[model samples]
Target chain A: MKARVFVTLKNGVLDPQGKAIANALHGLGFAGVGDVRQGKVIDIELAERDEARARATLKEMCEKLLANTVIEKYEIELQA
Target chain B: MKSAVIVFPASNCDRDAATALKQLTGQTPHMVWHRDSELPQVDLVVLPGGFSYGDYLRCGAMASQSAIMRAIKAHADRGGAVLGICNGFQVLTEAHLLPGALMRNANLQFVCRPVALEVNETQSAFTRKYEHGQRVVFPVAHGDGNYFADDETLNRLEGEGRVALRYAPGQNPNGSARDIAGILNQKRNVLGLMPHPERVVDPLLGGTDGIKLFQGLLETLS
Candidate 1:
């Protein structure tokens, strides 16, 4: 089994990279782009066969290292 | 005073820190590796600046989980002095030894220059040699020096005078909130800052504005 984690800056947190990307897009003529926020995706291969157990462990990873809860949030997705 | 400098792989400023300590305190600091778990008894431990773990995941993220951090945390818990400069500052925040996170520079550019900073609170072990409101120029070299925290936490830090240093007005190099250049932990034994004070301890290096910082620590901790 595999799991993917998407980590993004929190709503109130400033995302300078995201803003820079947005500016570059606008300079390149993408006017429709709204406020852009950047994040990262991490994929992990888990040996656990139980979905519940995998989810629990992944959550722990997010809290411990995958994301900095003070400025970022994370979402987990499990795949077959 | 006995001092030790934690040297994580890729820590480029470890030697600079060690030199500063030796020059000021007249004692050679122990160069502790990141893999080591035990710290020889020392009055102060320094987390020097560098791209520890290649700044993977985030600046200082990987190094924060190093085995040596366990002992560093224990030392801080017992009120031992800890000075974290630049990347070390990021590691301290990542380890939850201090509040706030050092995000990418607000300009999305690596900022490396001397910026004027004022000693906001001279009561901590790190800033006691400087007078309150004293202005000094320290070089800051980092990509992720923009400090961020919730309004409540910022307010609490300000209310408690935990902000040890603040960038001189309009001299914010990385857009740190409230122009915070450095902060002290609640116990005031741990200090995390983005500027490189150790890099300027000698007049031949550049300027000697940073010597008082080490001298102050030696005075208080010895």
Candidate 2:
């Protein structure tokens, strides 16, 4: 089994990288780009067969490594 | 007073911190490695700034799980004083030793400059040498130094007077909420700040505004 984790800065937290990207887009002549927020996508290959077990382990991974709970939130997608 | 400086794999400021401690306290600080399960008997423990574990997962995320952190937490539980600077502040937040998180600078640039900070409230042992509302200049050098927290937590911190320092008038280099530059734990023994006070201990190098912070802690040890 494989899993993908998407980590993003929590809402209301400032996103400097996203803001810089938005600025770059505006400088490139792209108009009306309201706002941009950046995120990280991490793919993991697991040895577990049970989805429940995978979700639990992935949650630990997110809390421990994939995401900074202080500033970011994470969502996991399990795939077969 | 005895003190120790925790040295992670990639910590570059451990020496500076150790030097400051030795100069201020007249005793060499124990340079404890990250893997140590125990810290020496000391009055203060400092987590110096640097890219721990090369910031592998996120700033301070990996270092928070290292063997030494468990000891640091235990030490804190026993009421020992702890100070975290720059990357150390990130580790303190990641380890849940302090409230709020340090995010990237609002300008999306690595900020390295001498920022003037107002001594918001100096009731703690960390800032007892300074007067409230006084301005001090120290160097801040970090990418993710913007502090953020929920409104309730922020309110509680303000009410408790745990906010130790704020960017001085017209000088919020990182866009931190409420212009916060440093905070203290509920017990007021632990302090985490984004500025590098150890870097400005001597006037010949640049400034001496940071000397009072270390001196204040020394006074508390007596």
The C-alpha stretches of model 1 lying farther than 4 A from their native spots are: none
lDDT of 1 by residue, A1-80 (tens): 99999999999888888988999999999879999999999999999999999999999999999999999999999999
TM-score of each: 0.99, 0.96
Scored by TM-score, the top model is 1
Question: Candidate 2 on A1-80: residue-level lDDT in tens?
Answer: 99999999998777878988998999999999988999999999999999999999999998877888767899999999
Model 1 in CAPRI terms: which quality?
A: high
Off by over 4 Å in 2: A30-32
Residue B67 lDDT in model 2?
Answer: 95
| Separate DockQ for every predicted complex | 0.95, 0.77
- Candidate 2 lDDT for residue B61: 86
TM-score (0 to 1) of chain B, per candidate? 0.99, 0.98
Give fnat (model 2).
0.92
